[model samples]
Target: MKSNFFRGAVALGALALIPATTAALADGEASSYKALDEFMDVFQKVRSDYVEKVDDEKLIKGAIDGMLASLDPHSSFLDARDFQNLRTQTEGSYGGLGLSVTQEDGAVKVIAPTQDTPAWRAGIKAGDYITHLDGQLIYGGTLDEAVDKMRGAPGTQIKLTIVRPGRDKPIDLTLTREIIQLKPVKWEVKNGIGVINIVSFSANTGADVRQAIRSIDKSLGRKPTGYILDLRSNPGGLLDEAVSVSDTFLERGEIVSQRGRNKGDVERYYAKPGDDARGLPVIVLVDAGSASASEIVAGALQDQHRALVMGERSFGKGSVQTMLPLSNTTALKLTTARYYTPSGRSVQEGGIEPDVRVPQLSDPDYKNRPKFRESDLRRHLINEIKTDNAALEEDSKDDPRFAATAEELKKKGIEDFQLDYALKTIARLAAKPGGAVAQAAPVRKPATH
Candidate 1:
């Protein structure tokens, strides 16, 4: 899932809305009195008759947590301190080490350091577990608490002791906090290919991506023969941005659809008329970290056959959240609907499988093992049963064509294997007898950083 490091405070403020209502209804009629009486009765019973003693504050918080947890993982309840952190993140400035850290197997591990931040400059890589922060042991602390300790004012220095997978001993390093302005989208031209790295889908992401593509076109004198969209480690962003990005690539077709409990929940997004790259071959890269909006774009493109999805299966997150406002600058983010690809496939527990599966190349010993085969995956959820009289579609797992494709990918090595395969596939498509260039579109120049 996309890390909410930047929007942590906003989410917290949103959560505070829930309790405000409890106070407003404090002097309600007989119905309200009865409801409160019943609630207290249950609370007393649980406290006395239950197996264990529960702290009042912790019990209340646990109840709130349980309520939010049932909706979706992304929708969370945040306390006042967590709300402040979320605010700091959305403002695009923070005092701490400038690295995204998460709890993994009881230890705090560095996910990725924001580009140009102190953590990135200090050479902290992904998968490094933080053992200590400022001499305080961090092995047992919650990820949120650890983050609170790390964040501070500019010029303040914090020390971190880290343990990497391949390292023998933990390494200690001191870092100074700075104002971190996250540039969510970055682009460049490498070997005649336009490569765009989307770190997160922030508010300005759609514009950033458009400008990046335009800049690459201007620098190259024409659009590149192929484009590589790197969504690795990107936890998703705003839903509209995902739709906008897909719209840029597709000339027409449904991009994504949403279905809620009621008819009002059903909504479909379609692509615009103009094609941004004018038929350029596109390759989207995804991994376990890619979720939500990332999955939307990948699923849409793959379903429409507009791009070749080359990477591991994405982090499955196909739910929609709506933030409801409360009186005291707080809100409640609730899961209102589930989303699906144009092909009507829901990517909930089962994520969007790539057109071509490519394993990670870091391990040499497992290099020869087949990463994923057609038979390995479960049936596509949407295609399993028909609601009305629609024809029953056969599962991709049972199709010979899908099996052959998996076999083809297994023969290729994982180290840059997906990119190599995509390049060859594009070359073959361009060389086809009836294939024709779309148009000679004007190039767009990029602005220097």
Candidate 2:
């Protein structure tokens, strides 16, 4: 009798929920139709009564772009040309100025110029605003249009008017376009230390990094004292490449975990059972330009205790973007998930803080140069939990160790002060009786499975 009563109660409860659920769903559909009607009304009116004859395709594209723009800076609608450009970029070769830029209130802002690119050679620092393109005021244009203007034939030259903070005059620069072939990994042995510079995490970046380690060992005829992973001014790329690179150094344990909207929707990546560097001390160098995948690598190594991160705070872009192909020539890049470091730290607005706060005394404008990060962008996702790193910043200020100026550093034959300091620090660690490897060990043991 009790079982029959329970079944009857469940049937009645389900019946009671059906009407309310149906009503709520019907209301939602009605509201959506109403919004669509309003959109269609505006579209029709604009088509019929606009001052100029605007093509339907242009209007539709603009509407789509505006919708995505309202969502987030990273999310966007890629047209045919834009889609092709993205594919070329991930493949590590493109015909452009090699600049990663974003739009802010209609103004194009430089994120970071790729190393060895025309923009980098021209001294276009991050946080500079691009006001004009080729003598035309492009202040209120779309980012796509500005990028299109900057890219052209290999020999073509374009003029740019930049407005940098802490500067009086608007600087004018003339840059020639070229095929930007990105060398994802470049390695060299400097004073018994292996320095590997990862410019961008493009295609095959992981394999390239592994090969770089082999090449460095081959050149030295033995293992170097330590390794410096230079990721400064690197505006991040493929997520898989970042995971693979982190896995190379980490013998085991969780490298990173990404959580989607649902509570249980989580995916974790782990390292295989192999340490490519053989437990050697590693130092990662990052700056305000290091973002996304760069942050992933830095955060992983730092949390895993596999490397000492030395430099300024990273760009703090921790959200994962998934490319949803809409058609053969276009797609929607949507922000899907927020990634966490092995220690469960979200690097969204608060970037990866270096273990050692080493300033770039080599750059003359290091003191005055403004920093651009993910938080500065409009519509950026907010991190609910704030990272308590204010004390870290306070500690770095007025540090006597980094008081030397650019002129003084040049006199000392140190073009890159941060790198020199890192190299010297590694040397000192190696000079210790037990070596750097003894001091450097993973916080957790290798996972058996």
By lDDT, who's the top model here? 2
C-alpha lDDT score of every prediction, in listed order: 0.70, 0.89
Q: What's model 2's TM-score? A: 0.94
Report the Cα lDDT for residue 432, model 2: 82
Task: Candidate 1: count the clashes.
Answer: 7
Candidate 2: clashing residue pairs, number: 0
Q: Give the per-residue Cα lDDT of candidate 2 at 37.
A: 98
lDDT of 2 by residue, 1-449 (tens): 99999999999999999999999999999999999999999999999999999899999998998898888788888889887778777774767898988888889999889888899999999999999999999988878789888988898899999999999999999999999887789898999999999999999999999999999999989998989999998989899999999988888878888999998889999888898998888999999999999999999999887889999999889999999999899899999999988888889999999999899999999878888888888889988787655576656458789889999999989998999999998998788876654323445533420
Instruction: Assess candidate 1 and give its lDDT.
Output: 0.70
Model 2 CA deviation exceeding 4 Å by range: 1-7, 388-397, 437-449
